[model samples]
Target: MHNTRSSRGIQDLVDLFDCFIVDQFGVLHDGMRPYPGAVDALVMLKRAGKTILVLSNSGRRSAPNEQRLLRLGFQIGSWDYFLSSGEVAWKRLDRLLRERGGAEPLKCLLLARGGDRSAVEGLPLEIVDSGADADIVLLSGSMGDRFDMDHYRRLLEPAAARNVTCICTNPDKIMLTEVGPRFGAGRIAEVYAEMGAPVMRIGKPFPEIYQIAVEMLGHPPAIRTACVGDSIEHDIAGGRRAGLPTVLVGTGILDTLSRAEKAELFRRHGAAPDYFLPAFTW
Candidate 1:
């Protein structure tokens, strides 16, 4: 990719793309609330005829965290559509049951935000509701982005011995949090794997959620549509796989990529986010 224009703010990048597919957790809200410029930037995008959707790992089995955003003062009611990792988890579970019959509803331990299951509210499954006596653990955001590695290890030891598989709801290892970058389910899932427990990850930058997000759009989005996010692994990789232009947010999980990391990504997947912004402005 050749140099187009260089900018650090969201407003500066708006003219670069017509549609914005933003990552929810890190790019907008951290945990306590929405960042200062998130709302205004998104509003600008909308007013400028940009169609935006929050693409999130939370969509695996449910809608994105609208209530969370509302609590952060983002007025999410106006931005009605979002794809979450929760929805992806639900679909993955659905496929597993169908492909492998007699696989009873998952005796699952959900590892996500408090309101993550909006899409899986009545779905048939024996969800253990994290910290419960679950046969398997569904991992993701830590109860609204508050998680500790020590706590996760304590929870997993016994389950590993019992032959429980940990289902990773979000594959991104770290995310931008109010306190700074912190671990995500992808990191926890890795620990589970090292312990010899089976693991499965659903949602982006995994492929499952991407397909669903595109479907929700009713048709393939226009070429001008942009997959905006912070991580090259989930957001950028998934967007490229879906054949969409990607917008890399400088303020998200992977903001401080090492030289080697950046080089590896380009050498392997050729990621060159069409636009880069420090925050979602414009």
Candidate 2:
């Protein structure tokens, strides 16, 4: 059993934590805009000298995510650092290619929103039009707006047939879109995995991304750090794995869930947050 406490806002738990590893899409903003009082909550944290790190499962690089936040009215000094799964994966891929010492560039079948190639922009990779000719499948983003799951399945069937490995930077199963929630890249990666292709997920609920985020915060004590997000599978589980307390915010994914439904979800995911907030207010 988990001892989950209800928090009115960030203020209730301000003195309990020195650092905060916050999720972007759900906790801070939806896909299109910042949640009500989200920006002010961040500003309050900064004013209280709390270390704030916006950690996101976005498949886009850090710069693009940062630009989006800025456009959404997030000030530059609201957080101490920002890290994205795509940025981390890109750095690792770049390092591996450098160590290979002049090998042929790998052919990549890239999937992203609006044909965005920022995830692999500077990597030594050749973007192939067909999965049959690619060495690896890079599942960076989802185009659920234009393509449906059937289309994604058709696109990955050829690659799955060849047993090509897929690297999924964003492991979010559901994405909060302007219209509503949609299946995310992680769900697409699951489809490929179901078709017998190997999928390597690199994001929340995984250790590497959390380890990297903690390091970025100067290795603060785990007890003094808390992970805030709206998902149990990603945020709560990931925070537990990283040895930090977790806070569940109701501004995003948990907004529509009833109290009973939320409890069922906690049982289903086998993870519960240490604290729950009605919203991201300070």
Q: How does each model score on lDDT?
A: 0.69, 0.91
Q: 1-282, model 2: which lDDT tens digit per residue?
A: 258999889999999999999999988988788888999999999999999999999899999999999999998889989999999999988898899888899999999877778899888899998988989999999877667899999888999999999999999988887678888999999999999989999999999999999999999999999999999889999899889999999878788988888888899888889999988899
Off by over 4 Å in 2: none
Steric collisions counted per model: 24, 0
Residues 1-282, model 1: lDDT tens digits: 333234667666567666667888668766666666888877766777666678777634443366667767886544637777776676666676677666667676666655455534565567764444777776766532576788888877778777688777777777655677677678888888888889987777666676777677655445866787777777877888888887776665555776467657655766667666666665
Query: What lDDT is reached at residue 36 by model 1?
Result: 67
lDDT of the structure predicted as candidate 2: 0.91
Highest TM-score scorer: 2
- In candidate 1, stretches whose alpha carbon ends up further than 4 angstroms from where it belongs are 1-5, 8-16, 59-64, 76-80, 91-106, 113-120, 127-133, 143-148, 254-270
TM, every model: 0.79, 0.98
TM-score of 1: 0.79
